[model samples]
Target: MKSRISRLASVMFIGAVLAGCSTFGNTFYTASYTSVSDAGYVIPAIPTEKIPPQYRRQIVNYATNEAPGTIIVDTKSKFLYFIMPGGKAMRYGIGVGREGFEWSGTARIAMKREWPTWTPPAAMIRRQPELAKYRNGMSPGLKNPLGARALYLFNKGGDTGYRIHGTPEWWSIGKAMSSGCIRMMNHDIIDLYERAEQGAKVIVQQ
Candidate 1:
């Protein structure tokens, strides 16, 4: 009876080890979070459960000729890659323009703003007269379409009127819904805003 009990305990110990290893492996693929507070609003850390699994930010192996620190936006995959050294990138799910509104090109981030005020373009206001109330500008707040951060994109011609901005609509990620600019989750943008330089190159690929 003692020998039989010893065998059973060994088997149970092996099973527990396997279970612990499985749980540890899962953490590599899971989204990790850290508290982020910005402006007067305290932007909560994004819970993995609240975001689609595929849309969560992750480190990925990427092949690119562009140097480290370049921002490559693969609109087809609805992913934005911030290239890092050694074939790695910090990838974030993004929302791009919808249908005819899609555009592709290379530009540089000319400026960056925190808790940016949003001003609806005259053309945008024309399309939706209801937005006229915000034509002048919308104060920086949670309700603002440009959530906690904005990256102004500019090309040789000058300001392209396109922006890489944060949005409160985290669920819109990995979808095509924007007018023309790229939209990221509020938490993700805050992280990106800190890493990206004002003149970082941005490549938008269809």
Candidate 2:
């Protein structure tokens, strides 16, 4: 019985050590996916297991000619990459526009807002009359489509009417179900919001 107890303790110790190593080595995943309370709202933790590994946020070695701080949206892959210096990037999974709603272009982040109000565009309300009530704008809350943050995209012509914004629908990541705006998990968007600069260049690739 004593020998069995000793072996059990050894196994427990090894498991603890391995778990610690994983936490230390992957702090990005550990810290980014957890529940967060911000601006009087509590954002729930994401079910990491439900999300595929490829769609999770991570720093990767991305070879790109674009300068650091450029936001590149590869819609085909459902990945948004924020270029970093020395051939590296902070990549996050995203939900893109559906078939007929897809768009590709260069734009600048004209504005950033936290806990932003969501106003359904007139065209959107026309398609979904139920959204007519929100045409004036929906108050920011847990149920708001624009979750924790929003980065408004614009160009020389003016507002592109598109956004890189957080979504309450976390499961939508790595899919094409939006209406032209790029959607991200609330936690991931909060992280990106902190890093993204106003007026930064954004490239959307089909």
Candidate 3:
């Protein structure tokens, strides 16, 4: 009778531990990618399971001399780290510029817009003539390339013409396939937009 009672207690403890781990995993993904409504638009829930674990948004220990609130983009590794107090960072998977389109520099967030209009640069229109139809500007919506928010970057020269912005193509996260802009998953961008402030420093590294 004593042996049976000890075994039963051990089994119950193991079951409880397993249950806690399962609950944590579910809560982590569900809370991060839940659907949200903003500015009269319904932002759909992302299927985060399709994304690699490393690309998903998470807090991590980071070592950097840069002050808290700075944004650092690691193009090669395809990660964006927003520095936080206490030597930690909120990291998000990012989509970076491809090959020749890549750029690196220090800039500051000069402006921010929710559901921003996208106007193709004259050079971009020349390369992709179909975009000429939007020479004026494209209305903001789900199909819009800029997604739900935009943080415009600028330097002393003014208007670097690159943005750290949201993308509807969540699958594009953790890849190199953009036109010089840094792209974040729409859900991730919304979170970052709330945390990052105008005039925050941005560092882009190869």
Q: Return whichever of 1 and 3 wins on TM-score.
A: 3
The candidates, ranked best first by TM-score, are: 2, 3, 1
TM-score of each: 0.83, 0.86, 0.85
Which residue pairs overlap in candidate 3's backbone?
A: none
RMSD of candidate 1 to the truth, in angstroms, is 8.7
lDDT of 3 by residue, 42-134 (tens): 998888679888888877789999999999999999999999999989888999998899999899999999999999999999999999999
Q: What is the full ranking by lDDT, best candidate first? A: 2, 3, 1
lDDT of 1 by residue, 97-171 (tens): 999889999999999999999998898998899999997799998889999999999999999999999998878
lDDT of 2 at 192: 93
What tens digits encode model 2's per-residue C-alpha lDDT throughout 47-136?
A: 878887777887778998998999999999999999999998988999999999999999999999999999999999999999999988
Instruction: State each model's CA lDDT, in order.
Output: 0.86, 0.90, 0.90
Position 22, candidate 1: lDDT: 21
lDDT of candidate 1 at residue 49, scale 0 to 100: 76
Consecutive 10-residue window with the lowest summed lDDT within model 2: 22-31
Q: Per-prediction count of colliding residue pairs?
A: 0, 0, 0
